[model samples]
Target: MTDRFRELVVNDSLVDIQYKTDPPTETVSPRVTYDRDDVPHVYCMKKTIPLSAFMERYARGEQRMWLAAYRPSNGRQTTITFAKHDRLTFGKRFIDAVAAERAHLFAPAQDSDGDASAPPPISSKKTAEVSSKAAKKISLEELELSLALQREIGRLGEDAAYRHEYVRLHALDCPNPAEHIVRISEDDVGAGYDMRSTFAGQTRYIEVKASTTRMDSFYISENERDTLAKVGQEAFIYLCRVDRDAPKNSAVVREIRDPMNPESGILLEAVAYKAKLSN
Candidate 1:
């Protein structure tokens, strides 16, 4: 072999040895980045899940999780809403509802009675909320709405549209979703259920209750109880438990089928009273 060729072979061998002994230097994880206006923006990879799915998977499908995102660059603010508590004022209630929920600070949406004009008690058969405990009358239906319970849900005012849409989407899924679900509350407050879903020759009388607290406590109006008795197996309730800080994987839709039945896992208290006034 020529001297120059031998020298080249020796150099190649040395380079191979160097590669076998050296260790790699850098490791990189997956990330998302955007460059705009000659500026670099980097973010960790995150899945943009739908709000409905977020609600369904959160807290066993009993409550909702809310997030308020403020994007100053886009001049957009995301606001959340629930009914207010009676003990707390408007500002305090707003802050508390959005704050980290503590056991003591936890309060479910109040019964219907807080509005100034008393839009209407949220306790009718078609109404999705309960009546104010404070409202008094000879019978359950005679309670006064002006007592102002200042609850955190079932306002049935501007928020009614939101609740209706939320319940409608959550009630059922079909190719023609809107067509199968009828909003009974909008047309008839005495129907004993908020929405009715008719699918595949089966019908469901659905009572939609939007709850802000984690408690399972609720008051059933006379009409609702009567309907539960009349439609034994067809009775269904969608108890939506809403929380501003519900976990990302919590449940949004919890269906209570045959709600009044013992096998349904719901506890119902019954009391038949005959009180006669004696002078």
Candidate 2:
């Protein structure tokens, strides 16, 4: 039997084996002895029959075995389990799945040419050129429009903050109060445009003017004026008044109702109304 056991060990890695006959309800410690060379020699416990029986079956080729090792950090004795064929098969399938998932996760991104080689230098240069072209350019009309829009945006921002705080403090606010939306100039286009929140909503367009007082009129580009006329009654004009000295939080927003006529390119009488911040 010992010689048969030696043959069974040919392809197996040596491991410490602990065994129990009764089903384990909790962990248990068994006394073990090792040879002077540190090889496990004997296992003694309340149920040593299972370990002996397993060895016998393995030698007779009547059972298969798989070994696993574990080490605990709390200075507790390490443990190894000798699992049978069914458990070993389950463990192998689980390990294979985990390995496949890990390989997929760490897979490298493919290059444009479908190879792993680094991208060409000209590709980077082309990207830089495209970016430079998209950068905003300074034109006289764009510069004037941007300055005006900036002033309006600054004023609207303050008004919004004040209104938000005011509403928070006074809970009895109206169902629909007032709202402000500010956008700065970009793409070398500084014209103000109106956007309706919904298809059925009223149209509101704003042309901002920033000055010491409301005395100076600002320029409205051809495109800006055309957009306003197209929207009809839904269109409105927003006037922002700013003081250069009091730049921070220094402006006020006022709206002028339907201020343009598309068919006749005429400017309608400006009916200025103060912006309400509640909504």
lDDT by residue for model 1 (1-279), tens: 111112111212211111111122121111112234322121211333332222222212122222232232453433221121121222223223222222112334455785333232333432233347654212121111112222434433214433444455556554565677778877898988877766767777877665556646776777987797688778887766554233222233467888878888877776445689996
Q: All candidates' lDDT scores?
A: 0.42, 0.38
Candidate 2 regions exceeding 4 Å error are: 1-200, 262-279
Model 2: lDDT of residue 264: 36
True-vs-predicted CA distance for residue 45, candidate 2, Å = 89
| Cα lDDT, model 1, residue 124 | 42
| TM of each candidate vs. truth | 0.40, 0.29
Error of 2 at 187 (Å): 7.3
Clashes of 2: 3
Which portions of model 1 show Cα errors greater than 4 Å?
Answer: 1-152, 155-173, 244-253, 270-279
